[model samples]
Target: MGFSSRTFLVAPDDTLWRLSTSKFDRMLRDPASHSLPTFARQRARMASVVVELVASEPMRVMRTTYSVLAFDAEGRLDPSRFEEQQFALVESVVAPVIASSAEENNQPVVDATARFIAQGGRWTPSPALARAIDEAALEQRPCGRL
Candidate 1:
């Protein structure tokens, strides 16, 4: 089990914007002019998507989805097996990541509920991961099945 983390720029409205480690470091050193899309939660629509985050991503997705739950080989919900090949999605609930400005690419990315991609090996939870799970559910990004 291992822990992975990425830096993000949080918006005033509590939206998390992706930030690269290198970029974050550079931003700390130099405040350059940059612009990001304004996330209008009210305007963003929801769509259901299958998230399958594996240690090795077979394809690239323009949008990212996060899932917090995983099922074991026996189809049992195992909190510890999220990092394994345990993956599934609820078709009824729609993920809350689709928006007007989110059409940058046509690729697919599966953060596997945003929780399954914790590590390449066994899945383990950290304080940050725990919080991320909660946020994923609230946003309906890819977990909790609504």
Candidate 2:
């Protein structure tokens, strides 16, 4: 069996502890606001568990899978349905964090993050992204620096 993962580059001023703490705190303070039918208050509490698991680790890996609706028994792609699902994930989960971080740091809006998925669910970053990751690695600050 194979699995896929997405790695987020933590900026110099950010730490997994800080990010996790902030997220946990925010969810705690506004449970009603963050709650969704699929992600209710109990589901939100799982964030603390995840934070605990990764606190002492520099990098944590989690498995993720994409959702697709099957309109046919043969499992063919439905472009419109697929696009709608992807856009919803991006808009609801991905965009807000990216936009907020950009705004906080006074960075330009990132129209897209390029992704190349190879056979067996491998991810290959573009040259520019690879360079950025390398640069970010060099700039990692001491834990709790910010």
Best by TM-score: 1
lDDT (0-100) at residue 118 of candidate 2? Answer: 12
List, residue by residue over 1-146, the lDDT tens digit for candidate 2. Answer: 22222223222232221223443344335534432232211101111111112334424323323232222322222335435545655565666687899899998875543221111122244555444433333334322211
Candidate 2 Cα errors over 4 Å, as ranges: 1-61, 73-75, 94-146
lDDT of 2 at 41: 18
State each model's C-alpha RMSD to the native.
20.3, 18.3
lDDT of each: 0.34, 0.34
> Which 10-residue span in candidate 2 carries the lowest summed lDDT?
43-52
Pairs that clash in candidate 2: none
Clash pairs of candidate 1? 61-107, 61-108, 61-109, 66-113, 66-114, 67-113, 67-114
Supply the global lDDT for candidate 2. Answer: 0.34
